[model samples]
Target: MKEARPWLRPDRAASGGDIWKKMKTGAGGACGEDEMSGEKTILVAGTWDTKDDELSYLSDVIRGQGGQVLSMDVSVLGDPKLPTDVSKHEVAEAAGSSIQAAIDSGDENTAMQIMGAGSARLALDLWREGRIHGVIVLGGTMGTDLALDLCGALPLGVPKYVVSTVAFSPLLPPDRIPADVQMILWAGGLYGLNDICKASLSQAAGAVLGASRAVEAPTFMRPMIGMTSFGKTVLRYMVTLKPELERRGFDVAVFHATGMGGRAFESLAGDGAFAAVMDFAPQEVGNHLFGGLSAGEGRMTHAGRAGIPQMIAPGCYDLVDFVGWQGVPAPLRGRECHAHNRLLTSAMLAAEERRAVARSICEKLAGAAAPVAFFLPTAGCNEWDRAGGELHDAAGLSAFCEEMRSRSPVNVDVLELPCHINDVAFTDAVLARFDRWVAEGVISH
Candidate 1:
C-alpha cells in the first residue's frame, strides 16, 4: 500500500519563491491606485505548507478564466504582519514545526475558533484594501471552518465560494456558514488538478469576475436620505416618501428601528453618505424607554449633529416592540399591548414613560440643520394608535406630543397633523418640507 503523503510537504521543484517576490512587488503597485487592474483579480489564499500546490493550481484556474490571480499564505511571521505572498519554508518557519501547536487540540470547537479568527482577519484586511475582488476556498472540514471565516469577512457585495469535501456530509452545522455563501461539495480531498475541480472552480471564477465587472446601476449621485421604519408604522412613508424623494433626485435609504438599523442609519448619516434624514417611526425610543426588544442604543439623532437636514416624527411612539405577550416585562404587562404578528409585539407607553421618551428624543435632535421639523399626527401615528386599536389612547397621545414639544428646543418645529400619518395629506406635507429645505439649500440639492 502507498504511504499517505503528509499534508505539509512542498513541491520544491517549482519556483514558488519567485511568485512570492512578484507578489510583494505587485502589492505595492496595487495599493497606490484607487482602481485595480482593468480585469478583476481573485486572491487564492491558504496555508503555505502542503496546501501550496492547491493554491497554485487554483490560481492557475482563475487566471485561465480571464482573471488575474494573486496568492496569499496565511502564516504569521515574526513581525505578525501578513506577507503579500509567502513560500512553504517561510510559512513553516513562521509557525513552529510542532504539528500539535498548529492542530489546535483544545477540542473540535477550539480548532474551529482558532481557524475562524485567523482566516477572518486575513481575509478582511485583503478585501478592505481592495486587493481581492472575490474569493474561493477548497478545503476539508477544518478548511470549511477557515473558508467561511474568510467568506464572512467580505463586504456584502463581493462574492465568496467554498468547495469542501464535507459539504455533502452531516458532520458539521451548516448554520456556522452565512446564508449568502456559495458552497460546493467536493468528493474526497482536493489533492491535485482534476476535471471536476477545474470545471467548478473555473465557473466560480467566471461568476465572481463577471459579476464584478457587470454594469452596475449608476450610483445615485443626488444626496442620500435615510429614514427609519418598521413593517407597520412606516408602511405609508415607504410608499410615499421613498418615491417622492427619488423624484426630487434624493436617494432614499430606509432602515428599520430594530436595534442595529437605527444605529446603521446614524452611522451612514454621520459618515456624510446621507444628506438628510426623515426619521419616521422611532419606535426604538419606546423600546429603549420601556425595556422592549428593538431598542436602539442611545445616540439615535447623531445624524442631525452632522448638520444634515432632518425631520423627526413620533410615527409609532406609543408602542414598545416585544417578541411575544410572554416576553413583555412585568412592569409593561398591564399596559396596552398589541400583537402586530407572531414575531412583533408592542406595548403602549403611559404618560410618564412618554415624557422620558420625549426627553431622550429631544436630546438626540439637538443640532439638526436649520428648518428641522418634528411632526405629530393628532389622529394617530400607526393603525394601532387610531380610534379602536389596542394602542389607542387620546390622552396618552396628547401627553406624549405636548411633552416632546415643550422639552425639545425651538429649532425643532412642532407641527400637528389632523389626519393619520398614512393619509395623503401627511405625505404631501412632509414632501413639501423636504422640498422647501432643498430649495432653500439648507441641504444640498
Candidate 2:
C-alpha cells in the first residue's frame, strides 16, 4: 500500500518535475501585483499515502481534459506509491519543519496539522508565482481538512474544488469556508472507485476545468470601496450607497454581515484591499458586543489599522445576530427579536449593549492613521429599529449616538442626521463625507 511506501523513494523513472510540478519563483506583476496564470495548470492535491490510486485517476482525468496536472503528495504517513511531482518532504519544509519530525512525533492529528499548514503556505506561494491556476482535491476527511486549509489560504479569486464524502457538514465552521469554495459529495468514494465514485470524479474534473477556462473579470483602476450591510430588510444603506460610488468610478464591494462575511471584510481591509470603507451596517459590532455569531474577532479594527479613509454608521447596531439553530442565549430569551429566516434570528439590543457597541467601534477607530467619520441617523439605524417598528428603542439608539459622540477620537467627525439608516439623505451624507476625504488628500482621488 502507498501508506507504507518510503518517503524518499525515487519515482526516478517518472517524467521530469518541470512538466508536472509547481513552486514559487516569485516574479510578480507590475509593483507586486498578484494574478492567476492563463494556463490550466491545476494542482491535484491529496493525501497520496492512502489515496494515491484515486489521485492518480483524477490526474489522468484532468490531463485528458487538457489541464496540466501538478500532482502534490501531502501524505505525512510515508511515501506514495504513485508518481507524484510535489513530495511530502516539500510540504513539510514549507511548514518550517521536516517530514521526519512529523513522523517522529508519532501523532496522526499533529502530523496532519503540520502538513495542512505547510501545504496551504506552499499553495499561496505557488499561486503568487502563477503556477497554480486552480486546485482540485480528492479526500474523505483528513484530505478535506487539508483542502479547506489550502482553499482558505489562497486568495478568493482562485478556483478551488474539493471532492469529499463529508462535504458541507456542520463539522466545518461556516466562517472557515471561503465564499467561492466549491465542494462535491464524494459518494461511493469511501473505498475503491465504483461507477458512483467515477461519476462524481468526472463532474469535479469538469468544474475546475470550466472555471479555469472562464475569463477573469478585469480589475478596475478605481479605488475600491468596502461597504458593509446585512439583510436589506434591516440595513438598506448599501443599496443606496453602491450606485453612487460606482457613478463616481469607485469600485464598491458590499459584504453581508454574516459571521463569515464580516470577518472577510475586515480581513481584506487589513490586507490593503480597499482604499476606503463605508461601514454602513454594523450589526456585526452588536454581535460582538452581545455574544452573537455575525461578527468574528476584530471586525471593525482592520480598516482603521490599514490607515484608510473610512465612514462608520450604526446601520444595525440595534440588533445582535443569533442563528435559530443555536436558539437564543439564556439571557436573550423573551427579548424583542426578528427571525430574518429560519437560519438567522436577530435579538434587539438594550441601551447598555448599544453603548458597548459604540465603545467597541470607538476603540477600533482610535488607532486610525487617516481621517474617519462616525455618523448616526437619529430617526433609526435600521428597518425595524425605526419609529413604530418591532425592534424600535429610542433610548437604545440614543445610547449609541451619545457614546459614539463622546468617546470617538477628537479628530474623528461624529455627526447625526435626522433620517433613517436606509434613507437617501443618510446615503448622501456618507458619500459627501467620502468626497471630502478624497479632496482633502486623506483618500486618493
Candidate 3:
C-alpha cells in the first residue's frame, strides 16, 4: 500500500481543512458574518481534484482577510478531497455536456476545452447574478488556459488574478489576455505547497480581495463615445473633440491606438458598451495587415457588428509601427523611420503600401450595420506628415487619399476635407457630420 500525502488526506488539519470549516461555521473571527454582510466573494477556480490542497490554502487566506471564497472545481477525471461550491459535474453540464462524456473523449485537451467553456459560462453567470465579486484561478498551463477564458468572460473593472507556473511566459499571447488581468508566477508550486508557494498563494489572495474592495466599476450614466487616437504629438483631434463631445451630453473614452489599448477598445465596443465610435486612429488595421505591431484581428469591425455608428478616419495611415527593440523589419528597412522610444519605432510606408492600407480601412468599414462616415484629410493624416514635418510625403499622402476615395463602399459617406488632420477645420468637419447625424436620428443622444 502506498502512503498517503499529508495534504491529500481528508482529515489533515494542516491542509487548511480546519480553517475552511471555521470559515463556514462562523467559528473564526467574522468569517461567516462578513460573508453574509456582502463581503467580496472571489471565485477560487482550478482543477480542484488535483490541486485541492493549494486551492484550499488560497481560500483559507481569503477568509482570514474577511473575504469569502466560492471554490469551483474544473477537474475532469478525479474527485476533490472536499466538495467545491461549483463541482466538476456542474461545470461539464454547464457546457451542455456531462463529466462522463468529457472523460469518454479520452483526450486531455478536448476534456479541458469542455471544462473551459463551462467555466467561462459559469463565471459570467455568477458575475451577472451578483454571486462573485472577483476571481482568482490556479493552474499550470491547463488552468491558465481556463483562467484566460474565465477572466475574459467577466467585464472590465472586475478583479481577475491568475497564479500559474507559466505566468508572463511567451506561451501566453497578448491578444488572449484581458486588458486588466493580474498574473503571479507560481514559483515552486507545480505539484504541492511549500513556504515559497504559500507566499505566492497568500499574496495573490490578499491582492484579489483588495482589488475587489477597491475597484469602482463603470457606471455608464452618460452616453459614451469611444474614440481612438495616438498621443497628442501625432493625433491632436481627440484633445479638441473629447470636451466638445462631452458638452453635447456624451462621455468620450479616448483609446490609445497602440496595440493593447486598441484591443481593450474593441472588446468593449464588441460588447455594445459604446453608443457610437470615433475610430480616427485606425493605424492598427495597417499594422495587422502588414505584420507590424498589431492589435490582433478584427480591429475596426466591432462597433459595426454591434450596430454602433462609426466616424472613421485615416490618421497615421502613412506609417507602420513596429517594436523598436526588434530593429526595423527587412521589408521596411531604409524607409523614413522615427524611433519614438526604446519600445516603439515608426517607418513611413511607400506610396503603394499607403494605398493598400487605405483599401484595408475601406474593407473593414464596408460592413457597418449602422451609418458609417469616413473623414479624409487630404493635406495630411497625421501631424508628423505635415508639410514641414519629418515624415512629409506629398505623393504617398495623395496615393492614400485617392485610394480611399475610389475604394470607399457605397454605404459609407466620405467627407474629403482639404486640411491637415490636426487642423481645427478637420475637427469641425467631424463635429458637423456628428451633429447632422444626431439631428437625423442616425445617432441617439
Model 3: residue 421 alpha-carbon error in angstroms: 0.9
Model 1 residue 379 CA deviation (Å) reads 2.0
Candidate lDDT (C-alpha), each:
0.63, 0.75, 0.84
The better candidate by TM-score, 1 or 3, is 3
Task: Output the lDDT of residue 395, model 3.
Answer: 94
Error of 3 at 344 (Å): 0.8
* Clashes within 3 Å, all models in order: 0, 0, 0
The lDDT leader among the candidates is: 3
What digit string (tens of lDDT, one per residue) describes model 1 on residues 283-306?
787787677764346546556655
Instruction: Encode model 2's per-residue lDDT on 1-445: one tens digit a residue.
Output: 0011011112222211111121112222111244434447888999888877788788888889888888889988667885688889999998889999999899977888888888887777776666777889888788888787888776656789999999978777665676578999999999877898999998898888778778363243466788888767667777777888888767789988877788778766665557788887767877876678755667888777666777888777777788787799987898888888889888888888788888888887888776788887899988887789888888888888888878887867888899987888987888788778767767663
Which residue pairs collide in model 2, if any?
none
Model 1 misplacement above 4 A: 1-39, 43-131, 135-218, 232-234, 295-299, 325-331, 369-371
Arrange candidates, best lDDT first: 3, 2, 1
What's model 3's overall lDDT? Answer: 0.84
lDDT of 1 at 87: 38
- 1-445, model 3: which lDDT tens digit per residue? 0111111122322211122232233321211233334688999999988999999999999999999999999999999998999999999999889899999999998889889888988887787667888999999999998888878877667799999999999899777788789999999999999999999999999999999888876555566789999998889999899999999988899998888889888877766667789999899988887778788878998788767889998889888899999998998898899998999999888999888998888888888778899989989998889999899999999998889889999989998899999999999999999899879867766
- The residue pairs that clash in candidate 1, if any, are none
